[model samples]
Target: MMIVCAGLSAVVAGGAGAQHVAVSVQVSSDRQFVPLQSYVQGEVDGKLLFFCGLSDMGLHVFGQGAFPAKNFSRQIVMVDRATGAVTTGTTDHLPLATRQAMTVTAPTAVQYGSILYMYGGYGPDLENPGDYFTRALCTAIDLVQVKNALQASQPVPASAFTHTECVAGKVAGAGIVKLGDRFALICGADADGEYGSAPDPEYTNVVQIFDRNVSYVNPVETLDDGQGFFSPMHRRDVNVLPVRMPVDRAGFVVVCGAFESGIFLYENPLIWGEGDAVPYEDNEFIQHIGGYEGPIASLYSASHDRNHLLIFSGLSGYEYIDNEFVWNPAAPWTRQIVNLHVDGGVFARELVLGEMPWPLTNAKLVLENTLPKTTDGQVLVDQLPFGQPILLGRIYGGIAAEKQGSVSPTYASDAVLDVYVTVTPEGPVEVRPSAFSRVRGLHVSGGLSDLLQSDDLRLVTRPDVFRTSAVPPVQIQVVGTSPLQNPSEIKFTVESRASANNISQRVRLFNYDTQKWEQVDARTMPLSDTTIVVTISTDPARFIDDATGEMKALLQYNALAFTIAPIWQAGQDLTMWTIVP
Candidate 1:
């Protein structure tokens, strides 16, 4: 039986009878002599093998495109990229007739010319962790054609590899990618329940790299073993384990959800199982740039930089909820919450409080295609090794008594309290909030319903607090009138309102020490119709101006307000206000 292989072609219709056909000849075949492994598109020696289908006989060339090549019981004809033609190849090229009876499970394959590489997956003797048979994989190279058959096809003797224990069943999971001068097969998880039974700390931590011209792959010898790349964890039941080859990174490979612990990367070849696997102990491993509430579901590397990874929502195992964060390998992954003033989108159109932007793509081109490109706010400008001090705009909305007591006005009094503000972005991009300006007064809405009214100037009021800081639950100094004639009680409160035309308003208090805004407490009266009165017994010398001999109040109350409105397009019509007296 003669094996037929041909490259695919394309025809372009031009003026009149003039036609152009783009033809690229493939002197090789995708058919291989081994069971299929995972399939991927890659360049071998600068040649693009468009459609690569896997079979135990040999990696066959079905065409030079993404052509469906499953079900061997049917005819085995591959298309040619050069002539836009299809021709029959070898009759024994595939074992599709009896593929269902094959004992191997999770069979996958990838080909570069005649060289077909098959790796990891369960086959035949399926057993539990204890009784499971661990078989490795078989690697075959150079199944070139013996003769150039027709002008349209090439002929090669049929070849197939026998399954071996090295790559047989021990191959639990694998993904393939061609890099530089070799093919890298990332082997992971447990196939036969070995790790599930007694539990091995190094099961999913292993990776194998195969060089060009090698027929067999030795997991221990092929590539770098992940040393400092993994976080150690006790073995347990695992299901729905999924891995992906993110495109942002040029040459790096990352695997996630081994036992639902965390994501691991091969920053350098042979990185797994080498140095300390414990993230806390191993300083060489890529430090987590930030902490995410849940395990990562997807990670996208920057198109230009490999050091940055964009993480998307995934389960934290606790809530099965999705959280996002940007992970920089150079720094320890720390979790941060950034309050953003949002208008509309998949995420709610309000200020995202106690939340941060999830890093998932290359920072270089994140907002390149947005309506208008933003340079400063949309991108990360600086990095604080220990997180440098930043100015967070604050709006004082309310206040609370730390401990109930007859409050007195004195710098040494334990009742001395601090203030803070939480500044959230009004849009998706980055923003730097300015300090509260007395010139920029606060504008309070009559009520929640007042916010729904458009062009209703009467519904807007200017009685809100105004303040500034660069921290969450921001902090401020509470100053009031001094030398009180009679003791009275004062109450402070913050209320927020949102509507469709002009909705998405929020308020939160601040903490002086932590330098951030405390969650807003709205029950306190924002502006009580009645003033809080306090008794004063201090010496007149302390309150009276030395030159004027008149008592004056040193402390003052602060207020702030914010409003957002949508006028057809997104991120338009917004107002911010702050007041202090």
Candidate 2:
């Protein structure tokens, strides 16, 4: 389901002041022989090179028989982007060590030029049965030669592959990116035993840099805040992309990652530049969707001085219900697409673009039509033809969930989709306010009948708190002109000042289903004047009466009598509510 916010501009749209651009996905008819997920891939000369990944959805069990060797992808797969022809090569012809290291799941892989470097993956030991360990090996494959050998159904030449043993390559699910001549492997875990067995998995909190030949080039730099309480860099299975930094420099942005303290997902991102000695955390922006590793594409619009990172469907802590934002504590798998916009390489904001045709995780995008790009591969969107739909790329193998959340059944995705982007002329977006009325105890200090009718801060709405009996509940009614239609968000704003005697204030929403007032923890009282904005994500039909087209909110103020009696005052204009319709 595509949920378009009423006033949101088109994501990644090029041209100065362009506000409308359509981003969409078209499913291809071609299908793979078997499903694959959590794999490493490289694209060269219109051919995609696939290596080291799982053939099944994922391991559901915790320990012991978690990673079964039978589910490991044993063949080297290749796909022709133009013709949709697939070619497979068996790994049995290669050495056991090389085969085992190249076929493990969730290894850090990055393609520079034509060479694909894959490092650190976890799987069953080929030499020792039932024993699974994170491989401390790095394998580099010549994409051109490997693709030729696999197409002819010939044994993969040993010279086409090279393996290196390095202490830094002992982790799995890390993100690898090439900055200049050096490669950086960031944040993953080293599993010593079976999954979830004794000896818990250890997280590598350092970024390991290596040379083109897969040898350590720089001393490992740790990612921590010195206090050692909770570091944002302690993450894995994250989306790391090569981006254009300020002043046309090269850098990397590590997006939302998994398991903060082995439980929650990290919402913010960490950025590193080629000139900097260490990466810094971006705590200002919080990522609500696509919190797991998935297909991502980056574009830089030089004309507009903006960088756009397109994030596909993946696991997230939030979801949209009919276009309204709803928080999900479970961090369920979502099909929502998001665009992270960085203005002038500094300020950032997340825009909810549409969603994919289906839920995809651990997928990869291969650009079919190459556009102008920087040294680090960020597409120069300004160079793209305007007012035309450009074929961005083709999305490949990943895990497809039957439904959202962990309880749903899943399978490795064999589906391929062609992504497209179109930029159009700008148009004005509208935001309207709902008519509001005071239903209960609040006495209007101004002549205004509706507190939300205008944005006049001088118009005050006063509620008497000196009443002896439970100060008659101050109930406010928000009336909509029409019934709830498409997905949209309703924002309730309250600007009020409380006297020194005021202890606490509470806001509650009336639920029609349960016929109860549910307390909403939007903010804490500060005694002084403050403004609180609460976004309502619940279905409008559930809260708004169908017959009256009205929704009610109850405000309760608690105060302790002291030398000065408690008084509460609210700015009528600033306390107005608006909705994205």
Candidate 3:
């Protein structure tokens, strides 16, 4: 008989002084209870169909003898949410390779309508005596038949699953997102050797696109910005969710993942839209919490043009202690639940809402409740009724750690948590007036001079007028106001006009922490007036000066022959700074 765990209540605050959204988790059992993690789960008619994953606590040990076949989750589990009835099925009818592929750990799985599409995972090869490898196979499971068989407590028919072999299926621990009719297999590894030994695993630093039938389309390699830096796409075991992009477009956001080099996790997020060739790495924002695979949910506020993403407790690189964000290089498991708000696909703000009841990791299944949602599965937050507790979704199955560290005793979590959100009534949105600040000093040709304090289009750095051998970047200093305390709260709008569309400018911000000038924005200026808004949302006070409260910026020019208009006021000039309340 299956045992159903009671509801565990956890109320997390939204934002600073925002209403408290009560979130809770209630464990439900449909049949005989079996603990599992890193499994593929899909919901059909209020029933959950769970496919291959790991049944052991924590992960496989790193040694010569790893990934024992006994630890593989071989049984198919089903849970009825309405009645709490649990059922199980077997994989004996599947072929050896298909069975091995179905039982492996951390395979990419995404449910599209009634079909559950599952891809490669790391496990033992049944064909070989003492070998384990990442399976190169994709399986399409019929959830309707699987649910029916499980509900009847009968064997699942072999026809319920269709297997295909392709090069795109050779990925494990990767994030999979459906872009319209195509599926993108994001960064992951294709490992064959034993854990922590011998040949290093190859990181697939490319997005493998697949059609609706899991056939290969093309691979989008990581962008080469000529910096020769390690691409952030070399990630695995991360969380990726379908997000509503600007103009209600479909996209996905790749959250933090592990092993940048020797177990250091990536702290930044990579965002990709539907039609983009590659995803954009948001270097300006550093995600401190929810850095690994866990329960994630998203809601879109069409009225406000913002997307709110709720990330539950998981592994993280930083933790808040004594009101200070402390960096943990070890990347330990955390109970921190973060709410990331993205406005117009440009700016992102992270708020630490609350924590989970305990430090849990690897619980990656979130079955959304029957709420009004868009076609891409984003909850329409604007249409929901206000001031009441709303059922968001249910989180099921992960590894529960005893402590928040790299080394800790763990167990397979049996908690089926019911996630709830209480939407509070918001006032009418206010459009804040753009605040402009004048440039005080200018540095050109290694000489410090005061720029003319005027609200006119003064030619400050014209290559054609000032016949110079090299175009020196004009450095400007602007004192920040008290309202501009953090980077996310401030927006820098630089307006400029060039003689030709080929003329480009690079904007760099001086980082006081690094003592180096970092390029923030670089774009080609058109013949008409152009405005570029740069927003930094990662660290609160990285670029600001502590003692003098001053910020420095540089404008580098590149063109055949062009002139840059100087700082203008009253929305008519080169530089303008605004703060969002």
> Model 2 scores what on Cα lDDT?
0.68
Question: 439-472, model 2: which lDDT tens digit per residue?
Answer: 4444545533333334443333345445433543
User: Which of 1 and 2 is ahead in lDDT?
Assistant: 2
Q: Which of candidates 2 and 3 reaches a greater TM-score?
A: 2
How do all models score by TM-score? 0.29, 0.68, 0.67
lDDT for model 1 comes to 0.25
Candidate 1 on 171-274: residue-level lDDT in tens? 44344444434444554444443222433423544444555565445432444334533433211111111111233112322322233333332221111222
TM-score, candidate 3, is 0.67
- The prediction achieving the highest lDDT against the true structure is 2
Model 2: lDDT of residue 459: 36
How far does residue 553 in candidate 1 sit from its true spot (Å)?
Answer: 65
Number of residue pairs clashing in candidate 1, backbone atoms closer than 3 angstroms, sequence gap of 3 or more or interchain: 110
Model 2 Cα RMSD, 1 decimal: 17.9
lDDT (0-100) at residue 454 of candidate 3? 23
